[model samples]
Target: MAPENTPVHIIQLIKEITGFIQKGSPITYLGCPLYIGRQRIIYYSDLVAKVMKKISGWQSKILSVGGRATLIKHVLQSISIHNMAAISPPKTTIQYMKRVIADFLWGWDKEKKKISLGILGNS
Candidate 1:
């Protein structure tokens, strides 16, 4: 009900109509964040971070290219499928996911500015 910069909105319940309770924006439905209307990408950062942690664990392991691709295509994609179904993901969120997947697929080296997309000796 308020702009992005604005703070909390208060709701006063009617003493006469003592049946329902009032809730606010940005509640979680199932595992996804639920809000009345459009929300910024930052809200979903924690969800993305959860996914990143999953990928990070796998990053250290030695898996074949096909295996990695499968995880990306199936597991990674499915993680946010429910959230995406509920609402469109912000551009930044999508980009962040892509970057994470790409980095996981091709080992990210601290020295290199960009990942090599190294699929040469995948097996």
Candidate 2:
């Protein structure tokens, strides 16, 4: 069973990933005249907000289901979206950024024996 509470490593990982992604394409506000000579990048807030909305909807659907395993299966099946979307945004894509962020924040990384330990307390 998944533990209750956010994980630290996952949080770190999320911060890292968010940093990496944002670094590659730093978003600039539209009509902002301060970047007249600079190249414009995609906005992180807009991308993140959209991704959050998609994940929120997905979580609601998962809750509607009765079984944890079913939720896991569905999530696994959609894992590709999570990884790919991080690198490239697609049209009408509902990537699983939330799950990735949540897992890194709360899930166990058994290989490294590193648990998030946000609320689980030194697993």
Candidate 3:
């Protein structure tokens, strides 16, 4: 691919990563420390951390190609757009369409099950 197109590809990857994080199923759930004894939050934080690490590793790789800073900037910009799209209405609706397409290409429950197993341990 052309050097200029690298930024666009990185942006698209960021968008995909954001959507995956926001809508992906919880990996684990534990009752709240207080409040309802059964309240739980998605264990997505770990997944996010892993993605960050991957990006950092990718950044190192990009540095060798001399596109490190530009790629990082583009990825961040795309993540901002994706974060907004994931929360708001019209954009969120569009993401749903994208998710449908992605699901068709990659099995619907594949990532969900993988993440769940990673977090919940073998039980």
Candidate 4:
């Protein structure tokens, strides 16, 4: 595929030489979307879903809070780092991930214990 403003003759020549069909942008490359235009949260939805899936999978396991924290640091973080390093994810996505982690650590029932994440982090 040719860049914007590329002459039609040149594009035709390249297509003829290589017999390649032209395609559009927004294709997934190395598990990341490569496209021109403004970035949107939708692009990173997969990353969010991945984090949720990982956390949900562990819900069945009986683990201590420390174990949950370890999984968050090692497993969840690793899953997101690749996409995060490539592009900045929306704050909403980050917040959702944090909330999910906190819920997993403290138990889903609000009445169980409602502690600020900052406070939880210190302890």
Candidate 5:
């Protein structure tokens, strides 16, 4: 893709020669955002939503602590590995993912208790 100010005729000529379709910015390629300019949390917001959805889906079940930990280690971590390998996500995204995982692991609704960051790190 060309820059924003690139001439339309040039783009057409390139497309005609290369036979590659032109698409607008902010497109997703391989589950990652492909866009011009600086990277922002907006681009990775979907990743957070996806993790939240996956965790929230299992909230109805009465899972043991081991089951929850296993899900977090295998499923929740796997979802973000693909995107994380490609780009540096914002701090907020990482923090949100951690919070969701921790909440799911410790049974947030029933106990309504908090886990310290140190305990989380050891686990």
Candidate 6:
């Protein structure tokens, strides 16, 4: 990789320390992509793509509402929670995920009518 704009002192210090290569922008620290700017759209683009992929999958649409809810819970929560613990995701990203999950739980076209909680056997 070409030389980055990292400080000369830090670079020299890193050079002094063994096995410390400089890492540049747009790095993934712990499975979550870290960007320099605070643009939620770009930062969450890969995540959104993954969600859209899951939504477009045949298995995603075929599951019943309960099953879809279960699967979606797994999809939205797992990695996000871990990433959130490390890096605070923007509020918009959280809202966007909620929207994605809602759209997935129902049909994207949203043709399904509302039903009571009791009918779904939830208390």
Q: Each model's C-alpha lDDT?
A: 0.70, 0.41, 0.38, 0.75, 0.79, 0.67
If scored against the real structure, what TM-score would every candidate get?
0.64, 0.24, 0.26, 0.67, 0.70, 0.62
Query: Candidate 5: where are CA atoms >4 Å away?
Result: 1-24, 110-112, 116-123
Clashing pairs in 4: none
Off by over 4 Å in 4: 1-25, 116-123
Worst 10 residues of 6 by lDDT: 114-123
How well is each residue in 1-123 modelled by candidate 6, as lDDT tens digits?
436887788777877786767576666666688876665556766666776777777465568988887776676566467777877767777778767666667666756664433322222
**Candidates by lDDT, descending order:** 5, 4, 1, 6, 2, 3
lDDT of 5 at 19: 98
Query: In angstroms, how far off is 51's CA in candidate 2?
Result: 1.1
Per-residue lDDT for 62 in model 2? 32
What digit string (tens of lDDT, one per residue) describes model 2 on residues 21-52? 32233433331212223332343335455444
lDDT of 1 by residue, 20-113 (tens): 4545666667668776567878778767987888897785468986788788778877888888888787878887877777777766765777
Which residue window of length 10 is worst by lDDT in model 3?
A: 114-123
Question: Which portions of model 6 miss their true places by more than 4 Å?
Answer: 4-24, 37-40, 58-61, 110-123
lDDT of 3 by residue, 68-113 (tens): 3344345533443543444332433334433332332233466463
Report the backbone clash tally of model 5: 0
Instruction: State each model's C-alpha RMSD to the native.
Output: 7.3, 19.5, 20.6, 5.6, 4.7, 6.6
Clash totals for all models, in order? 0, 6, 0, 0, 0, 0
